[model samples]
Target: MTALSIYQQHDRLLVAVDCIIFGFDGQQLKALLIKRSFEPEINKWSLMGGFVQQDESVDAAAVRVLQQLTGLENIYMEQLGCYGEVDRDPAGRVVSIPYFALIKIDEHEEELLEKFNAKWYALDKVPKLIFDHNRMMNQAIERLQLKASTQPIGFELLPEKFTLTQLQNLYEAIFESSFDKRNFTRKINSLGILQKLDEKEKVSSRKGAFYYLFDRDKYNKLQHEIKKFI
Candidate 1:
């Protein structure tokens, strides 16, 4: 065997990137899904992803796919995990690098998602995914929960100025349970990440609750503190 062929065969691997795109409309959390147009999973609903080209970096490949699907850049995304089970991908032996990205519904490049033939579905209403993509999404959700526990990444899915009720809704969705109103407010207030505004939102209540804005820069610079409410 040729020396190069031997080495290449010994180390050959398939690299793929899966994007878990998260979005939040005014009420519910959503995700962008693309109808698979490739072999092995044609027509299936899948995350925006692709095999990494020989000349591209993992991050570069993810950006390209995200851009092609969302038409936006500089969104919040981090490496979620790796899925390397021998049969994770049915097409062949492949390892996938997963990333979870967050974009506010108002900020999502709707035109781009449309042109790419992608649709946004609520997180709870997401359709079945191809291969191990569902596992990738679960891992991404865990990553988001961890960060949300200590950081202000939750704000990435919220509006610039939102109501306390809206903030609670985001938290409740992540926690997957209803929270006591008094305790929830107290705990969130203790974090000092929000700046209450003078305006009020009349959509959900008649009393018109005041609006608030999360201070992301300050929240990030602050130390990680765990504060839970019943």
Candidate 2:
């Protein structure tokens, strides 16, 4: 058989991309979910997703899906994995590549969310999702926890400047566990990748916590010296 003839022998499968977007709301980690508009499971909660277009790469498709719902670009996203179980999607023979994204909760465009009938649910409180999305979410959470421990990626979900208390809160939200305030602060201080400012966040207390910015330059240099953040 000719190479072209041999290539035509196999069955065709659809390729799709799903985005598992995580955000921090100062207390808990949340994921953005949309009400599916198409049938097979119309109106059901699902991860933001779409079929990969003929002209676009999987990465571009994921970015388009995320931006359609969040109205933001230049997001911090990473591929979680691929799901190709035969019956994972009752709709058809579709393979989905899921990407996990971290976004600052306060920065997303509210109008875009309203347009898509989307909602943000705390990770622990997320409702059952369509198809194998729950499985994808569980895996994304595991991957995020691993990434957060080894890299300073968590800063992507926080404001440009935040208090130590807020920083600890973000870590606790990601890990779903509490840390000793003093110890957490000490550990973060020891890293020397934070630039402390005179400005303080007084809304939380009478004696407010000073704000600090993540020093990306310092973090880049510190990466070679240290292996983990928590």
Candidate 3:
């Protein structure tokens, strides 16, 4: 192929991933966002991501983008969806493949998350995002709600040792609705994932609620068994 033909086949269509990093800080659901460092909306709040390279897969590119922006190498990430609107990115003709992650936020390099000026915005109250990012955020929130209920995946946002109250709070935040404390505890206890700890957290309640750990190994085993049984 000649230079002109190569140029035509270059496929210059810009490809990028927008990461919606969600975390639980023991109280509510939060999302990781960064200030854009490059134009066309330099310094504006946006999801952390970058262009895909010729040698990498979409998942690989998303991981690289997350690491570059937040310094987090391994975290729970899922391909939310693709936002391919022609005018989604103002900088150029680009198709932004959106991805989302749910982590403990305390699990990764905190210094980098802060050094990059990546701020954690409460899911209940988020800032105005750029371009089609608002739509992405909305979809992510819906996904979280659905995933939290049907699948035993909410543990990703909490510490290994979590309290029943903490579990309830996470559900409340995701659902944006109040739940009966007694019923919530009773229901979660039935799941058989929580491992009771002797320790108690008195930071909030004067009575001090007991701390419990969400055993992932057990949950995963049960999950697999469930599929086989079904």
**Top candidate when judged by lDDT against the true structure:** 2
- Candidate 3 residues lying further than 4 Å off, grouped into runs, are 1-11, 224-230
Q: Per-residue CA lDDT of candidate 1, range 134-217, in tens?
A: 888888888888888766778888878998788889887876778898888988888777788889898778889999988766
Clash statistics: count for each candidate: 0, 0, 0
- The model with the greatest TM-score is 2
Q: What is the lDDT of candidate 1?
A: 0.82
RMSD of each: 2.6, 0.9, 3.2
> How high is the lDDT of residue 74 in model 3?
69
lDDT of 3 by residue, 71-90 (tens): 66667788987888888777
Candidate 2: Cα lDDT at 94: 96
Candidate 1 stretches greater than 4 Å from native: 1-6, 9-11, 224-230
Assess each prediction's global lDDT (C-alpha) against the native: 0.82, 0.94, 0.81
| Residue-wise C-alpha lDDT for candidate 2, range 159-222, written one tens digit per residue | 9999998999999988989999999999999999999999999999999989999999998988
Candidate 2's C-alpha runs over 4 A off are none
Looking at candidate 3, what is the lDDT of residue 5? 91
TM-score of model 2 vs. true structure: 0.98
* Candidate 1: residue 10 lDDT (0-100): 77
